[model samples]
Target: MNLFNLIKKDQEYWLVDQLKVSHIPNIEYLVAFDKLLTEWKEQRVAYLSLLMDEENEDWLLKRRFKKVSSIVEYTKVLDGSYIASNTFQVEALSDSRVTDSDFATLYDLCRSGSANKNKLFSIRQIMESLERELGANWRDQCFIFSQDSMNYGISIPHIEQDTTDEGRMFYFGVVPEQRCKGYGTKFHAISLELLKTLGAKLYVGSTDTSNKHMRRIFEANGCRLRDIKGIYRIDIEKEFIQ
Candidate 1:
């Protein structure tokens, strides 16, 4: 497979998807992957974040890459009968106008003390991402709360991802203050119903193995573990510039 097409480029990192092939990635695949890393180093890639199938997880050791997390893909079929028992004021984010404060708060709540905290994004970076996320074919960012209290948020995809099957939910996060209050359960249930409302036939979401809090929420919603993806990262090799 072509490594170039599998990457989603960003200012800080290039997010790669877990490649699932019928046959194991042989020596040629490793050579190509190493070559890609070499080229990325020369291009100042800085960090290479790889999402790989469990089958291919061991192969990265050949390149001295370390595993950061184990990502599990959870999926469930939507029956269109889901309903949220709890009432939450759901607000859709406006595409044309999102402020820095909005992103700063959300970023902190989502990443702080979590698996992705090390991979930080500034307020400007968050806003820049919002600009891309709210563009055409992108779904709405829905924030759930009650009585002006900010609880959490969930995002629905307006278009299918090339890496996964149709009808996907991009992400959901509970605020730091609201953690362990069963807010995630309520928000996740509401999200499932909302996804069904948005015509999602199958709901797919992922979380790292170490993120038991988020995994519990997914489990509460009856989401099953379908695949285990190995997450790997490597610093750019300055000496490999040649």
Candidate 2:
């Protein structure tokens, strides 16, 4: 009875699968979640997070889950028509031989455009978690793009395991020094093409409402806005009282 995907980093975090309990009657999801919480208490899960659709929003709210932010979802069809750029070269992490210091620099680039004011995980935590989620070949899917030996940004493009043709840019960012220079658009386009090569026929992307840069990138890439979801969280260390 897997209710959510449990990811352990600096702390344990649960990504709730709303569809798993959608068939349950009103408040039944809450009952099921409560049982998992008790069983997982010794694991010290910091929090449980859920992207709320209308189906589970009402019941989730009843449990005093805090609405942290709203996420805008976008979708695009991959047509294998993307052309490679001659000006910039994209190198997969596995082939790039990025040193620890280089990785730290890349992590800094990701941190620069992060939407969360108080980041939940550290660099090591993030790296480990990504490896756990994406598996050993994660490096093959992570890439760095550069021009004239100067790096511009990074992108993690991969197909979602549950959906064969559905793809996602799990993470995408432009270095702080290169931001506002229109590199985000190019980087994202490259990622889309990369996903296509990975057998992705469609791409799904999301960004927080406050992330104007990312929102603009999605629009610039011509991705259609599909839906918006509320990001809700429950602190496991605290009592659940509404």
Backbone collision count in every prediction? 0, 0
Residues forming the 10-long window of minimal summed lDDT in candidate 1: 156-165
Which ranges in model 1 have alpha carbons more than 4 Å from their true place? Answer: 1-5, 10-12, 21-42, 95-100, 115-120, 133-139, 148-158, 163-165, 238-242
State candidate 1's TM-score. 0.77
Give the winner by TM-score.
2
lDDT of 1 by residue, 130-166 (tens): 5465454342554434435543654434324453334
TM-score for each model: 0.77, 0.82
| CA lDDT, every model vs. true structure | 0.63, 0.75
Candidate 2 lDDT at 60 equals 64
Encode model 2's per-residue lDDT on 22-125: one tens digit a residue: 46564665576677666555567778776655556766677767777777789999875655464688998889878645865786776676774335567776
Model 2 misplaced regions, further than 4 Å: 1-11, 17-44, 54-58, 116-118, 240-242
In candidate 1, the residue pairs with backbone N, CA or C atoms under 3 Å apart (3 or more residues apart, or in different chains) clash, namely: none
Best by lDDT: 2
